[model samples]
Target: MTSTDHDTAPADRTAAGTAPAPAAPARRPRRELAAATVGSVVEAYDWTIYGILAPYFAEQLFPGSSPTAKLLAAYLGFALGFLVRPLGSVLIGRLTDTRGRRYGLTLTVSLIAVGSLLLAVVPGYASIGLAAPLLVVAARLVQGLSVGAENPSVAAYVTETAPGRHRYFYSAVSYGGVVLGSALSFIVLSVLLGVFGESGIENGAWRYGFLFGALLGLTALWIRRGAQESAVFTAAAPGADPAPGPDGAPGKPGGTGGTGPAGAKRAKAPSPWPVLRAHLRRLTVVFAITSGATTAFYFVTVDFPSYAEGTGAATKEESSAALLLGMVALLLAMLGGGRVADRFGALPVLRVGFAGLALGTVPLVLAMSSGRVPVQLVPAVLLFLLGLPLAVSNVFAGQLFPPAVRAVAVGLPTAVAISLFGGTFPMLAELLRSAGHNDWVPWWPAITAAAALAASWGVREHPLPGEPHA
Candidate 1:
């Protein structure tokens, strides 16, 4: 209908008795996108600091364990932390659904900071005995839960705020923040390691990394505290005002509320059982895509260094440097992925990423495993193939469902998928390596890539969910 017709039409209905048209979704501001992505960045920082330093500090925290055993214990802690993420997703997801994205986000960041701070100051095994490892486990679990909630909520918020034409692109941009955080986290790590050297790192200097991560978490909390509530959540949440901020001033562009004068009420948050029953297929798709992204991600960043170092294709220092470069390359690729998705389409770009992973994962793994190739070659492989494809993951998930259950839908599946795959793949790869089954490592990520490919295949290449095609 023309603008004039829309304005001249009856407030509630046409004279012919049709219902009033739905309001068009509003264009969101870039500032909000920046706000939401900072949450993801903080999550990456807090989550990865331990992983980056686990090798050197393993003995200090879990003293008297053999080198391999110590690293294994540290990896166990890392994996266990991720194992608890789904529970966090459920609890924190509910908060976002009931309270508002802003509140949930604010709470999530603070929890992450607390986790980091705890890890930063935990006493060594010599001083605290088993308590050191216990503290490590506790801190990791808290960080894991915070990350579990932070990512989906941030993705939902960004996707809801993004312009229709660039929805997928905006969604993918957060992965860029993830890469930035990874890169920055490593830079902090490398600086500390260089300053303190291996013995010093083993002597408790590793704590600096978590301290840095805590600072990052606090900064993100500040940024997010100023962010407005997600437009989609504000529109969908019932018994709540559309405005997300405490001041009742709107920061995001769109919000919906009760019917005017008629006293007609809108829908409330549906119970979990019905919501779960309603979105089973989409949830499965979310799992598959998340599995692919998380598996590939963990392989490249978390597991690859150990695998490469084990093979002696790269020393520890070389592997760390390679990961830093790979993250930078991935950051550039994420930005590029966003633009490409905007121009071509989200599904197609996602498919391409999956395709790259499916075809390239094994070879890339093999290259790193060979101990024959140059150490730097792995970063180039990461840029072009597996790691690069994951840039579209956030938008890829966000495009599937409406906002009312967006956080839960995205969070739950992601939690399950990552809890199953992302959190465990590195440990699994470690097991495979220890067992001398280096050849088998690639198949784990390859299978997930293929699964993601199939999931993306089922999704129609199109505009944002609920949006009309041009």
Candidate 2:
């Protein structure tokens, strides 16, 4: 057949002939990924600081109460942020799918910055009585909305920018951002507590952590400023009367391919709700497994620090050292995990990671509880290491859907799962111990890891960034 004939041939026919040239290489997409990673890490640093400092914040804000009651209140406030996050995802995900990632991200981070600023200045319970906790809860809700909105945009942006072969590795950076942020919070608190002492932490050092959060939000805004709309998003065709942002400006040009005037509209895919319905079976798998995975990791990273100190497994000093070391390990593991996903694809890496996380969690926690000189540290480091599977899963999650619904696909379900599992995990652990089930706590991670493995198994080995289906 003539060359022209070959171009128009069916897929089977085309395979019999020479294939088309591969698409052009993505241009410095990793730079965009790096910026997104940095912004996310900064935001996480601010958000997680509350979790790390919960014990102190509890003492200061809810004095004259039982220790359990005080800590429980602080955690409940933290969980409140997760509760409102899904609503933010629904609101913002639609905007992201219809508008553009850049606009959605900008709006989200702006809200986070404002919320953190409020938390920094808000009065304690001593000063404001009933209003203090109320305000804290309200501020977290605001923070939740911003956080909910931010993830989907970042997920879409990174997935779109990543090169095909290396996409999973680049995608893993989102989770890496979480790990980095948690590490930073732990290290910073350790230093403040070690140098300034608990008296100092309660008096003013804790406030500094919140102030750092505000600064980080500002930094996220700054880094985001230099980002160009992704090539994939720019490629999407805008529809008529395209959704507008809070400002009068029109949303992003069609995500498919059209950058017109301020009010430009291009043809694009339908909303995510329809797609989600069509793929409910697959979506369920994504949500269930991912939820468990996220819960397990958050349990280890966020809850473990508080648990360690509260349970007397380690001194405040010892807990801080363990956390800091674990953070370093997590950083190394994430970077390495990303690269591994690039080489082997996401599934294989995740399978191994999940199993490791499951088996490792119970033994690790038990060992840490043993209070041996070196073993106490082993569990924290192992916890970070165990999370490698879930981190790898995140990279695949980013690539699971087309750019049009990618944000909603990854963000909404994960948000819901996080809300149910991540938000309430600490409280549940506290309850478990209080109820005389301390030995059973390790089972939580084990169960979660198993669920994650199932999810990893269900995930398609190859995902298309702009393809018609997930």
Per-residue CA lDDT of candidate 1, range 373-422, in tens?
67677765655554445666776676677666677778888998988998
Model 1: weakest 10-residue lDDT segment is 4-13
Q: Which candidate is the best by lDDT?
A: 1
Model 2 segments beyond 4 Å from truth? 1-27, 240-251, 254-269, 309-312, 371-373, 463-470
Candidates in order have lDDT scores of 0.73, 0.69
Structural similarity to truth (TM-score) of each candidate = 0.87, 0.85
What tens-digit string does per-residue lDDT give for candidate 2 at 1-470?
Answer: 12321111111122346664233222456567776787678667877888878877776675446878889899889889999888988888778776677767777887888888888888888788878888888888998987876767787877766556556666677667877887888878877787888888877678788888888888888877666556556445354223332332223554433534344544555756877787666667767766767677677667665567655686656666776777677667777877886776667766777777767777767766776435346545665556566456554666667667777887788788878888888788888878877778668878877787776656467643323323
Where does candidate 1 stray beyond 4 Å?
A: 1-28, 243-248, 251-268, 367-373, 464-466
* Best model number under TM-score: 1
What local lDDT score does residue 97 receive in model 1, on the 0 to 100 scale? 68
RMSD of each: 4.9, 6.6
Per-candidate clashes come to 0, 14
